[model samples]
Target: MTPPSRPKLSLRASLFGRFSLADTGHDLRPLPQQPKGPISMVMRLGAMGVLLGRTTRLVFSARTDKGDTLRLAHKFANGSAVFIVVAMSFVGMIMVYQSTVQLNRAVGDTQLVGAAFLKLLVRVLGPTVIGMLIACRIGAGIAAEIAAMAVTDQLDALRLCAADPIEVLMVPRLRAGIIAALSLVIIGSCASALAGMTTGVVLFSMSPSTFWNFELIDNADLVQGIAKAFVYGVTVPIVAGAVGLSARGGAAGVGRATTDAVVGCSFAIVVLDSLISLMSHVVAGL
Candidate 1:
């Protein structure tokens, strides 16, 4: 005998059943709650303590590193800075003499020519001294520090310790760089101005008052130049530090990082200077 006929399924019911099964299969399970035990609590506390300690150490290390870098840079390069300043001063003197002589021939005023030469000399000296000082001191130090850090794997260790390496290391260096740059600009400008005045009086026979008469020698230009230097200082150290921190392999990596830091910083300085100059012109126009 034939078995009792099975109930025929409608298309809509079949579709519904299939969808229901799929929905049930795809439903997500609730996440398990973490066990609340004494051991777990202790572990959590220990982790927090380690985090706090690392943060404290990072802050302290940044400050100490910045101070040490600045000191070393100044100590090692002081003599070189002085020599550069002297050489630039002499060059300024020669340039001024030539400029003044040409002007004198054109205008038939030898006295005014000598006065112009003195003014030019003073203006050129200050900037020259500042540039050389920064180049020899801050520039080299940044390169070396980044290279050493790369060589030592200090940066990698920082990452392993869960530190934001850039904030800890780069920010302080950037701040120090700004300070150094501004100091160099101010000191260099004064040195150059004095040298120019001296050359005018001794070599070109110009009066001190006449040499200092130009309004361009005042705070406006000096401030603009210092601002440019400040940008350079901040950028150089940061780029150097970043390069060093990202270095890999071994000695070869350190060498590459060091070279990249120097070349990159120098190029950055020139680009920043140009941008600042353009901005200054725009501001003046406004």
Candidate 2:
């Protein structure tokens, strides 16, 4: 005889869908929506802290697949190169053009434009813009991919094999992301500088040597840029992975996760940039 039919359990979603309940074939249920407001913020922060701690432990104290990390690094770098270069090149050109226009209209001194621009690019624009761009591009890809896997039950398969998905999937991306981000930041910065130099020369008839001056930039600027890029690199994957892993449903869930990843990564970049800049200034004042 067939097994007795189980009772049909009906559950209702709460307002804002935070506690939406669904019945998967194996009694699977969507987790509560991540809450908002101050208390929710605190709770999420604690959860993220735990996640980062676990990831850090896995990366440093355990053996990760070296080949996988390298492969992902290569993919991240190559895939991002053209986008970063072209975008940065345009940014450099626009900034130079605008600065020159403003300087010409005001005090008639364009000599300081390149110097000041270089300083800003190194300490602010290069790292920050690259971070934002990577958040939009790479972060979305990571979220979509992971969300798809999660929705399709592949993550469950990993659990069945006694593997921590974070160790198997996210750790490599974290390592590879850092490597790729640093390299791309350097390349994008060079493209921006060169494009700015060319813009000054072509548009304003400025001497190439004069516009290429590096007088305003120092060790501090270099350190800050690298630090920002490094932080952003680490932040994007973790944020994206977290969002993706939380995904449920099917295609709609993947799309939502991708959008969330972009928004979350961008916000993280802005907050980190502000904090890093604040710390740099505080330290420099000493």
Candidate 3:
């Protein structure tokens, strides 16, 4: 019996055939499943600390894509600025109103309201609020993008191409995050101050001069706020990247990673805030 003749391959297929499995052969190993116990949780936390240390080193070494870092910084600032401004404006107004009302009821003296509020905003409220917002906005994005790459083995492909994923993927984000955090904190703090002043003038019948007082704040408060913003900025990307790099399964895993990233970022922000605040207090006392 005569065998059937084979069909000729198309020129397009012939041209592309050699690279058809270009995405294959790389390690696609998924990380271990999510921790289910105290010990596992502790281990995961330790791993995240190690990852953070490595990323911080790369950032300090200046091993990053400058264009990418600038682009991401712009995106983080522009995308989040409006949200931060609006939310913080409302928060400022509400805080001023409530505190003024309470103080007025108690002592009929709201003269120091602006100064106290500004002090709190500069030291605690502004940075913490901004950090939480960034954690929700940027942390999820970083985790989702990197987790998708991780599950698809693109990270491995980068490794095969002699690219360090930490240097390429994580360092730019860490740098950008710092810039965004500092810029947004400044912008958001101004918005909150303006809003608080407006509330005082309109609702409380207080003069703008009185409500815009800066008497209660000092260099220490400004330094604390900036320090918090800087730390929070560095933390969000590192935690998100760690969560992302450990992603497994598939799309569901990516979603899980994003959730974990936000949660981790928020928890880190709160914990760091307490520790830093404590340290600052101790230093001031000394």
Candidate 4:
């Protein structure tokens, strides 16, 4: 029998198959065209509005979510900080008294040290009150807001909607944090000054008028403290929000996020404070 004729391969068919293959060397399909309509524009605006609304809602909710945890933390931190301040102030008062007592004795100026003590007390108390108020108001708010958003799936929704979540979520928090930090620092500084001055007068017998007159606080020192507080403020909220957004597992996740926020913020504050101190010294030397 004659050998069966080999099935002829159609060149055109082979070429077509090659071209149509999913792993083809080249894809010939045209790129999709952009939408060109008022409706598209409106949709884009709507998405933007949603992002804005969510961010605003979170911020507003943060203010309302102030809780006992925050209050307790504030009281604890403030009391501890105040105690430390008092101890340091006492040391400073002793030094000031030692330094000025001889001058007073020599000049018959018994009120000099008393005035200085009063001023120091005022400074300390002012800053302490301010710090406590801020820690309670802003710290707790951040923790609650971030934890709530995480639990609500708002962050995931933002990702699905192709939104730049960082800009939408973090920017506002950063702005708020800076403002809160500055306000707190100012208040804290005032409290510390007042407390120090008071302690000086009551315990050390320093002169109030002379203490106020002495320019012990430099502009640079004040600026450094404010800058440190502002840095802390910005970092704390962002970190808390990030932690909350990334939380997994349900109520447990929220708890983790809140705990992380508080611990992380506190740690960051300490680190930033050290760096600021170094920078301040360098700048002052210059």
Error of 4 at 197 (Å): 2.3
Residue pairs that clash (backbone atoms under 3 angstroms), model 3: none
TM-scores, one per candidate: 0.62, 0.87, 0.87, 0.52
How do the residues 1-286 of candidate 2 rate in per-residue lDDT, one tens digit apiece?
9998864423222211221111123224443454578855554445445556667778875466789989998898899999999999999999999999999999999998899999999999999999999998889989999889988988878767877777888889888889988998999999999999999998899998898789888898899999999999899888888778767779999999899899989998999999999998898841
Give the lowest summed-lDDT range of ten residues in model 1.
Answer: 15-24
As for candidate 1, its clashing pairs are: 121-196, 122-196, 125-192, 126-189, 126-192
Off by over 4 Å in 4: 1-137, 159-163, 283-286
lDDT, model 1: 0.53
Which candidate number maximizes lDDT?
A: 3
Q: How do the residues 76-191 of candidate 1 rate in per-residue lDDT, one tens digit apiece?
A: 34534565556656655665566666766798554554344434333333443454446545655666675677568675576567655554555555565666666555555455
What lDDT tens digits, residue by residue, belong to model 3 across residues 1-286? Answer: 9997654543222222221112233323232343358855675576567667667777767555589999999999999999999999999999999999999999999999999999999999999999999999989899999989987988879878877887898889999999999999999989998999999999989998888789888899999999999999999998898888777679998999999999999999999999999999898851
TM-score of 4: 0.52
Give the range where candidate 2 is weakest over 10 consecutive residues by summed lDDT: 14-23
C-alpha RMSD for every candidate: 18.4, 6.0, 10.5, 17.1
The ten-residue window of minimal lDDT in model 4 covers 15-24
Tell me how far the alpha carbon of residue 85 in candidate 4 is from the true structure, in angstroms, after superposition. Answer: 14
